[model samples]
Target: MSHPVVILGTGLAGFTLAREFRKLDKETPLVLVSRDHGGFYSKPMLSNALAGNKTPASLVMKDSDKMSAELGAATIHKGRTVAGIDTAARVIELDGGERIAYRDLVFAVGADPIRLPIEGDAADTVLSVNDLDDYGRFSERLDGVTSVAVLGAGLIGCEFANDLLSRGISPTVIDLAPRVLPRLLPDAASERLRSKLAEAGASFRFNVSVSRVDRAGAGLKLTLSDGSVLDAGLVLSAVGLRPRTGLAAEAGVRVNRGIVTDRLLSASAPHTHALGDCAEVDGHTLPYVMPIMQQARALAATLAGNATPVVYPPMPVIVKTPACPTVVCPPALDASGAWTVELTDDGCDARFHSGDGQLLGFALLGAATKQRQALVSQVPGLLV
Candidate 1:
């Protein structure tokens, strides 16, 4: 009997690769393993789910069995934790010592929420909505909460704040940076977005972080670095996400900020691959959906007997904040550029230009977002 090809996750990456691979070759036996309930859902919707009045149950697009049938997977292992991988033996060990051999193994394990070590009694009570399970519990906690204190002013944090406001629950946003979206947008662009969100019942506190969290009656009392205390019905930690590398690292697969993979999305070992938020392809770790789609297409081709290297074009992320409505394409890390911005009553148009007068990136807010395609055409591809 031939060993079946196995995938270590059921998230968008795993399912997408499976779907794409089946389109080219269907004879190979396929299996999928998931640690959670194993359902198909758009993870990006979690931040703005409240605004659409969507329940947790409604967010799930397809259950595991349905997805398995649609993708032509022979085995869909739901609620099964993959404890370890024996790359030499070409088998995956389960939690209970059960092992299954694989012809090829793909790691779509995804990432984890970064947890800060806060010196407080109620630090463990702070919540982060990373996955569907986390979102379900967060929704449960929101039943009686009247307000939220969001830690971070980045993409997810700001979107959640906007969503909270739409539900009539005001949010107090705290960030260590002096401005919101410190890593993605220019100062002037961030300020315009901040002004709009503030007008819609969002409060911003910059250059401060939570030093501690203590339970105060039915709410959480947060102690700030400036010796100030803030109270909120619920505390949300949207600090950031770190790619999952423990499992691959333990298996002796090259792991860095993420599981290191070559242009073909292959690990150091033969028949081993990694993609999605877990894989750092040629030193680029993009956790967004667009890059994931690009990786999925390329990895699927390689798995279907076609060796194809992944390429990334100019992909701009649309920030899902109804209050501000922004789109941003960040410049390369090593690029030397300065932001040239113009702010108007309708919106802010900001461009990151190279020294020789070339457009490297752009941030468009409100009405200026209409220029997305035009500006994107000017930006060069991240990887050709």
Candidate 2:
């Protein structure tokens, strides 16, 4: 009997594992399922779409049929979701009354963009750019809009602002935090970045919350808690992402912020694994390509009987804000240490050093980004 393996999701993690597994066990029966179109595209490309002068269609590298053919794997482009999983029987039930069995299963369901609850007809006007389909839909509405309001001044928000500015559309960013990218940058570094973007025509309103949003004639009027309103042609929400963990949780797979996995990417269930933005490894859910790729390799090896332990290296995220150029390896959220910032004329660098002066994290922006390699080398290994 051929060993059959099933992988959920068609994003980077799913595709990477399928390709890796094929290298070692080509004869194994592999089945891939996805809710979306299952086309292969870089997730990071969504942020730089406008700056790269590319449409959503142009960014697609391959569709499901092409990828399935190239990998020699069975692909189910079923829009129906995997409703439940029976780990004891090693079978999964789909929403469309389909049942599939697998010797090994991988979950890479990725994440969902968080949408805030606010009152307004304009609330429907605010959209988020998460997947390729979302990007295509968003690009279509940008043709006639002159000004945009971006909620959340973090990495994605900054990238979108830069992209909009590149297209001659100035975006005004609104964040509840006192500084931009509060999760990544230190106060000094964030200030420098804000200054740079401001020079590029990106206005910001910090320490403010959007009380409500409403349709104002041809544009949107966003009311703030401070009794002020800002008008814009459109609004984009980039307030971060929440991992899709409900399915795993319902199946009794341990879940925190994401599906809990061990060093080998194994979930609580036997012969079952999880990775990518959907997997919480050692309490860390990194929704980035690099960490997901690392998890894919280790999990693939484990599935192939190698029992490889996933080793997480120091992964510094390179921010895609071309206007101000930033890179950050933020300290873990619960870490006890704080960062000290150093600002220079050309850029900003902030070091997250422990009480004992041990470097734990760092954020570099503009000319200071050249320190990424050396700084990354100084931080301790994530797995260690």
Candidate 3:
């Protein structure tokens, strides 16, 4: 029997790759291993779930068995961990000495939410929703919470804040940055969204970090670095995400910010590939759905003997804050560009232009976001 294609996760990347691979070659035996229940769910929806009234249980589209049948995977090994990989033998060992050989191995291990080192006993109680299980835990912890204190002012933080407000829970957002989404949106655009969210019952504390979270009667007391304090029934940490690379690194696969993969999504070891949040594809560690879609499709073709290189188009991220609708396509980190801003009371349209006056990136807020397709078309693809 031919060795199976063993995937190391059941997240969007792993399942999508399996499904796409089956579309081309249905007879290839596949196995998906996951640490959780191995349910098919949209991780992006967790941020705005409150507004949509989506429960954690309702978020699951399918369980492991159903996914196994649909994707033609021979087995979906739930609640298991890949202990080590032997590149020379081209096999992986699970916990308890169980070994499995594979014709190809794929890593879709995903990322973890970054937690700040804050003082006080209750700091461990702070929540960061990264998966369906984490969301379920958070939902259970929010039983009697009337106010939520959100740490971070980036995309996820702002979206959660807006969602909390829409769900009738007052949210206080704390960020170390000077402005909301400082890395993504310009000052004018950030301020516009800030104002709208504030009006919608979201409060902000810029250039401040939560130094401590302590028990205060029936609620939690958050002490800010600036000596200010706020009371909340729930504490949410949305600082950032760090890819799961320790396992791959221990197995001798080259890793940096993520498990490094080439244009074909192939890792350092032969017959091993990586995708989704765990993969830094040709130095691009994009945790978004768009890049994963491209990677999955390319990898599927490659596993089916086509060897297609992944190409990334101009992908703009649409912020899920209904308080102020926003879309942004940031210029590459190495690209030298200056932002040209057009700010208004209702909207802000900011464009990043190179010295040659070429449109490299842009941020559009409110009604200005309607020009997204037109602007995206003008910019070059991230990689081709």
- lDDT by candidate, in order shown: 0.92, 0.87, 0.91
Q: Which 10 consecutive residues of model 3 have the lowest summed lDDT? A: 68-77
Candidates sorted by lDDT, best first: 1, 3, 2
TM-score of each: 0.98, 0.96, 0.98
Put down candidate 2 lDDT per residue, 1-384, tens digits, no spaces.
654799999888898988888777777788888888877888888988998788888998998888888777665555668979999899998887789889998998989999888788778778899888899888898989999999999989998998999999989999998989887888888888898899999999998978788998988899987889999888899989998988888888889988999999999999889999889997888887778878888888888889988887888998888878988888877767878888888888889988888899999988989999998888887886
Each prediction's RMSD to truth: 1.0, 1.5, 1.1
Q: What would the TM-score be for candidate 1 when compared with the true structure? A: 0.98
**Model 2 quality (TM-score):** 0.96
Please write out the lDDT profile of model 1 over residues 255-319, one tens digit for every residue.
Answer: 99999999899998779999999999999998899999999999999998899999999999999
Query: Mind giving the per-residue lDDT tens digits that candidate 3 earns over 1-384?
Result: 789999999888888888889999888899888999988988899999988888988999998888888986568888999889998898999988889999999999999999799999798889999998888888788777899999999999999999998778999999989989998987878888899999899999998999999999999999999999899999999999999999899889999999999999999999999999999999889988899999999999999999999999999998999989999999988889799889877788999999999999999998889889999999988987
Using lDDT as the measure, the top candidate is 1
TM-score of 3: 0.98
Ten-residue stretch with the least lDDT total in model 1? 67-76
Clashes within 3 Å, all models in order: 0, 0, 0
* Evaluation by lDDT, superior candidate among 1 and 3: 1
Those runs of model 1 whose alpha carbons end farther than 4 Å from true positions after fitting are none
Off by over 4 Å in 2: 336-338
